[model samples]
Target: MLITLGRRYLRPYAPAIGVLLVLQLLQTLASLYLPSLNADIIDDGVVVGDIGFIWRTGGWMLAVSLGQVACAIGAVVLGARAATSFGRDLRHDLFDAVQTFSAREVGQFGAPSLITRTTNDVQQIQMVLLMGFTIMVMAPIMAVGGVIMALRQDVELSALLLVVVPVLAVVMGLLLWRMLPYFRAMQGRIDAINGVLREQITGLRVVRAFVREQREIERFGEANTALFETSLGAGKLMALAFPAVMLVMNASSVAVLWFGAQQIDRGAMQVGSLTAFLSYLMQILMAVMMSTMMVMMVPRAAVAANRVVAVLDTQSSVVEPTTPVPLASVNDGDGPRGVLRFDDVEFRYPGADEPVLAGVAFEAVPGTVTAVIGSTGAGKTTLLGLVPRLFDATGGTVSVDGVDVRSFAQADLASLMGLVPQKAFLFSGTIASNLRYGRPDATDDELWAALEIAQARDFVEELADGLEAPVTQGGTTFSGGQRQRLAIARAVVRRPRIYLFDDSFSALDYATDARLRAALAPRTADATVLVVAQRVATIRDADQILVLEHGRIVGRGTHAELLASNATYQEIVTSQMSLEEAA
Candidate 1:
């Protein structure tokens, strides 16, 4: 997975990667050449007391050292740039893929896990790329060159490499093999911790209301401890690797010296050659150690890469049209441009046995309010979702302006409809910023007009900064009613032709709700309005009302007509208001 992801994202930076490789090669060659020069300096210069030979050879060594340092610096700089660019591109592609996902796809990969994959998982792969470019690229070159150079110095002493290399390789290999599973577990544990933490933070109010502080604390602690234990297990294996490498390295050095001393007495090898051989051996072992370090990181990075690839590979359930119907063409007719029609719409969640909406049909024409009233699980929100193409219907067609929504360009569909979701979420920004989200160029006059229609102008005016009042994430700084009103204002600012309010007024008091709807009615008089509401009073005066039960419309009429003839509508009306109140 890591290799696959790297190939895809890093391919564009091939030029930079090429430069980095050349630099690494030059640096490794310089490193290998230095030890051979030292041997010559020892045997030819110092041993024979040749002053000019020492100075000349010494100058060459200095020049090689300088070249090595220069190449190393250049390689690191290029490697960093390529690695960082690769990470940036990977993140951008991942985010784009996620953006293409429909609500169903997002749900399949829970929010926390998706967040972890985009962030922490990407970071793991990024770190490996950075280190791999810097270290891994040079390890094999150094190892192979060191072996050839060591043979040049003395072939008999080079025999020590056969035993030393294998011992180090076997020891590090076993330890890394054991650590791989723990590394995989560590990423899973991280996802668990992120999930728990996100849930607690998002539901902090509910937790406080239920007095579950201690219980939540314990839950988070369990996830944290699990991560800690997994990391500790991986850490122990990592710790064991360095010591094992050192043990073999030191033992090999001792063997080389001992055997070389015997060979020296027999005139089979020189002291200078022994020293050069040991240096080459150290270089070889260091190269192996570098490779081993990268190997340790590879397992975790591979796991993370798989996760990132999963997100990138999974196709969004809602596929966009290859050739979208133009917005101008859709709205060209003399008929009401905001007309929304659902023709025999049927929707079932993936893998679900029953449909959420089945054989359902309705229309909200321009200059009219069409309300959907239903029991808690009647799929009111899901129905509204189809209008925005948040999730496409499994069967039938939903059209805006007599054009099937699937045929409309995503941006075109979005531009024509304004949706204020059931949950009024606001990003961390000023009130003005949030309101201007849908229409960035909307003027302050337009903003206030929308705020007035939503009945949010007064509270916003009372704030010290008014429209510039700071909003915390999810609008936690504001009350539910305030958030809902602001969300409504945001939609209003867009001035979209079709407005889908998914029980958007549920958070307000009865008086505020009535006043807001009354204020909203005039502003939206020329546009089509679809309201999904639990409160009968909120939609009592709609041009048409649809009462839903078990994913089918049980009744459709004006509020008075439904109240008089529809038992289901009457049950809902009477539950919320008395007969006198209804009258």
Candidate 2:
């Protein structure tokens, strides 16, 4: 999974990667060459007391030293550029893949997991790239070159490398083996911590309302502690691996010097040769240490890569048509206006035992208002969601103007319908910016016109900055009703063919709700209006009312007609409205 994901996104940067590798190879060769030159400076120049030889050797050494510095700096710059570009491209692809997913796929991978995959997982792979570019490419080159250089200094001492390198590899390999499972476990812990944090933050208001702050805090602590324990275990293995490599390296250096001294005493080797051999041995061991560090990182990066791949591999339940149904021309046959229909639709959430909405049917003609009213959990919001295809119905079809919604491309469907969700959301921006979301090209006059119809203009005008007044994230600056009004105005600016309000007026007072509805009536007369209201009075005068229970429509009539025969409707009216209002 790691290799596959890397190849796909890293394909574009092949030239940059090549440059990084070339720089690392040059740097490694220059580094290895300098140690041998130092040995020559000592043996033939100083030992023979020849000033001319010293000057000549010193000059060559200075040139090699400069080349090494240049190569190191060049490799670092190129590696950083390649690694950063790879991370950026991977992040872009992950975000795009997520955007294409339907609500069902999103539910399958919870928001916390998705967040982890995009951010934490991508970071893991990016760190690996940084190490791979800087160290991995150089380690092998240094190790092999160091071996040959050490042999040239003296072959007898070169035997120490065989024993030292293998022992270090075994110790580091064992540590890496033990860490793989724990790294996988650590990622799961991160997901748990992220999930708890996200839930607590998003529901802070509810937690305070219910007075569960202490309980939530305890829950977060448990998650945090579990993560700490797993991390400590991984850390212990890493701690052991590095020191073990150093021990073997130190032992090998001691062994080489101990044996090399005997040869020097017997007049079989030069002092310069013994010193150069030790330098080559140190280089070889340092290369092993560098490779070992990358080995430890591999397990963690592998786990994160698998998680990212899972998100990319899973297909969204809702997909676009290869050849979409053509959109209606500007002139509506239903007369150039937005007309919506739901024809015998049935929908069930994924993995659910039964359907949430069963065999429902409705139509809202252009210039008419169709109100859907029911008690809580009667599929009111579910029905509204189908029109916009937020979730496709399991059976039957939802359409606009004689064509199935699935037939139209997502953008075309969005252009024709404006929806104000049950829980209103506003971005962190000025009032004008939020309004522009509905119609990016809308002029200032059009924005004010929508605000007027949505009953939001008065409060907006009273603010010192008016349209420029800043709205905090999620409109935390405004009261519930104020946020709802802004959300409605955002929809109104679109001037779409269809308008869906899924209990959008519940936050407003009776008088305000009444006035807002009255104000909206004229502006939406040319567009289809669908309102899901909890209050009977809110939809009393609609062209049609559909009362639902248990995902089925139990009553369908005008207020007076239902008052005569629908017992359920009569009971709901009696509970919420006065006898006089009910009559």
Candidate 3:
């Protein structure tokens, strides 16, 4: 998964990657050459008491050292630039994929896990890429070159590597094997922590209203502590790996010097060769250490890569047709004029045992108001969702303007409809910005007109800056009713072919609600209006009403027509208002 994601996002930066590789190669060669030169200075010049040889070799060493530094710096700068850009592009693709998902798909992966994958998971992979480019690319070159140079210096002393290198590899391998599971668990716990934090932040008001701060804190602490424990365990294993490498390295140096001294006393080995042997051994061990460090990062990055892949691999249930039959009429050959039809539509949420909207059929003609009324959990919101392909029906079809919604491109479908959800969400921006969301180029006059119909004009006009009043995130600065009103105005401004009000008027007072509906009646005469309302009075004057109970529509007709024929309608009206009072 890591390799696949890297290829997809990092391929565009080929030039930067090529430059990094070239610089790193030069840097590694210089690094290896310097230690060999140092051994030469110690053995051939100082030991032989040759001043010219010392000065000449010292100058070469200084030049090589400076070249190594420059190449290392250049490699790191270019590698970091490429790696960071790769992470950013990966994040952008993940965000775009998430946005394209339907509500069903979003719920399957969940927001917190997705957030973790996009941020922390991507960071882990990015760190690996940065380190791999800067270090891993050169470690093997140094190791192989060092071993060959050491052999050229003295074959007898080179044997130390065969023993020391194998021991370090085995020990580091054991440690890494034990740490992989812990690293995977740590990523999961990070998701848990993010989930808890996101929930608390989003529902802080509910938490405070119920005064459950202590309980929430304790819940967060448990997740935090679990993550801490796993991290500590992984850290402990990593901590052991470095010291183990050092122990083997130091032990090999001791063995080499001890044996080499005997050979020197017997006049079997030159001082220069003994010095070079130690440098080569150090280089071999350092390369192993670098590679082991890379091993440590692999577990965490692998886990993250899998998560990112899961999101990319998920196919949205609502997919467009390969060969679509385009309809210019919505139903029964009625052409595009905002006519909507639901033909035997049945929808069940993923993993749900039964359908939420079962075999329900309805038609909403242009220039008329259709109300959907039901108690909580009556599939009111789900029904509204289907009209816009927020979730496609499990069976049957929904047509808009004579075309199956699936037949239309996503953008085209969105442009034809305006939806105001039950919970009004406003981004952090000025009132003018939020109002302009539906119609980016809407004039002030058009905005004011929409606001007037939604009953938001008076309050917005009273603000010191009028439409320029700043709205906090989620419209936290506004009251519930105010947010709902602003959202309604936003939808109204679009003047779409079809308008869906998902209990949009629940926040308004009786008088305000009456006036908004009255005002909207004339304005929506050319469009189809679908209102999901909880209050009977809110829909009493609608051209048609569909009353749902437990995901099934039990009554459908005008107010008087249903009252005369439907028992459930009579029961609902009786519960909310006496028949005499209703009359």
Candidate 4:
């Protein structure tokens, strides 16, 4: 999986990779030639007392050492650049793929897992790439060149490499094999830890409210312990590997000395040849160590690569039309803009026993407000989701301005509508920035106007910076009603033809809600409004009221008509208000 991702994402850095390879090659050749030069200086200069030969050879060695340092620096710099860029591209593609995914797809790969794949997983592969360029690229060349240079020193002494090299290889290979499964488990444990931590942080208030702090701590501790055990298992194998390599390396050095001394006494090997041979042997073992280090990182990186690729490969269920009808082109002189229609629309979650929405239908034209009132779990939000293609209808169609919503580009569809979601969320920015989220070019005046209509102008004006006042993540610094009003103001600033408010006014008091609706009437007089509300009072004044029960529209009419004619509507109204007040 690491190789696959590298090939695909690192294609753009081919030139950097080429240059890096050349530098590594030059560096390894320089290192290999140095020991040979040392051997010559000892045999020719020291033995014969030739100072000129020693000076000339030492000069060459110094020059080669400098060149080797230069090349090593160049290779490492290039590798870091290429690897960092590879990670950037991988993260970019992952984010784009996720943007295209529908709610269903996002649900399948939870947000915590997706975040892990994009960040920690990408970092793993990136580190491996960096190490590969610096180490793996040089290992093979150093190992092969060392063997040839050792033979040049003395073929008889080089025979020891047969036993020593194989012993080190077998030991490192066995330890790495044992570490792979633990490495795989470590990545999974990281995801588990991330999920648990994210949940605890997001729900910290709830935890405190219910006094579950100890339980939450225990839950996080369990995840942390699992990660520690997996890491410790891998760490133990890594600890064993280095010692094993050193044991063979040290033992081999002893054997070369013991045997080379006998050969020297018998006049079969010189002191210079024995020294050069030992140098070459150490170089070979060091090359093995470098390769082992790179391989140790590969198992974890390979696991991360698989996770990243899985997200990139999975296609979204909601897709754009091959031949899209432009959102503007459809409404050309065809009655008023902002006509919304739902025709037998139905939605069912995958692997569900029943559909969340079934046989649901409604229409709201320009200058009209259509309100959907439903009990808890009546699928009000699901029905609203179909209009924006957050989830496509399973059985029927939702149209905007006499055209099917699916037939239009998602961006174009979004431009024609503004959605104020059930949970009001704000990015960490100033009030003006959050309001301008849907419309970036919106002026300060426009932001103030939207805030005024949402009954948020007073609070914003009271702040020291007015529209520039800061908003924290999730708008937690603000009260629930304040956040909801800010979100509503954001939608209002867009001036979209169709406005979908999915219980957006629930956080406000009755007086504030009534005042905001009254202010919105004139502003949205020529546009369409769809409100999904649990409170009967919030939607009692709508031009059309649809009461939903168990995934179907059980009643549809004006509030008064429904109160007199529908038992379900009456049951809801009576639960919230006196019969006299409801009338």
- Candidate 4 residue 331 Cα shift, in angstroms, is 1.5
Q: What value of lDDT does candidate 3 attain over all alpha carbons?
A: 0.88
> Residue-wise lDDT of candidate 2 within 1-583, one digit each (tens)?
8789778877888887888788888889988988887888788889999889889989998998888889888888877887788888888988999998887888889999999999999999989988888899999999999999999988877888888888888888888889888888998999999999999998999999999999999999999999999999999988888678878888888898899999899988888888889889989988988898898898799999999989888877777878886675544453646667778888898678988888788888888889888878999998998888787889988888878889889888888888999999999999999999978899999999999988899999999999999989999889899999999999999988899999999999989999999999998889999999899888888888888887878888888888888887888888898757777
The regions of model 2 sitting more than 4 angstroms off are 328-336, 578-580
lDDT of each: 0.92, 0.88, 0.88, 0.93
Pairs in clash, predicted candidate 3: 329-402, 330-402
What TM-score would every model get versus the actual structure?
0.98, 0.96, 0.95, 0.98
**lDDT string, candidate 3, 469-536, tens digits:** 99999999888999999998999888888999999988889999999999998889989999999888
Q: Could you give the candidate ranking by TM-score, starting with the highest?
A: 1, 4, 2, 3
Clashing pairs in 4: none
Off by over 4 Å in 3: 321-336
Better of 2 and 4 by lDDT: 4
Give lDDT for model 4: 0.93
Candidate 1 lDDT (Cα, whole model)?
0.92
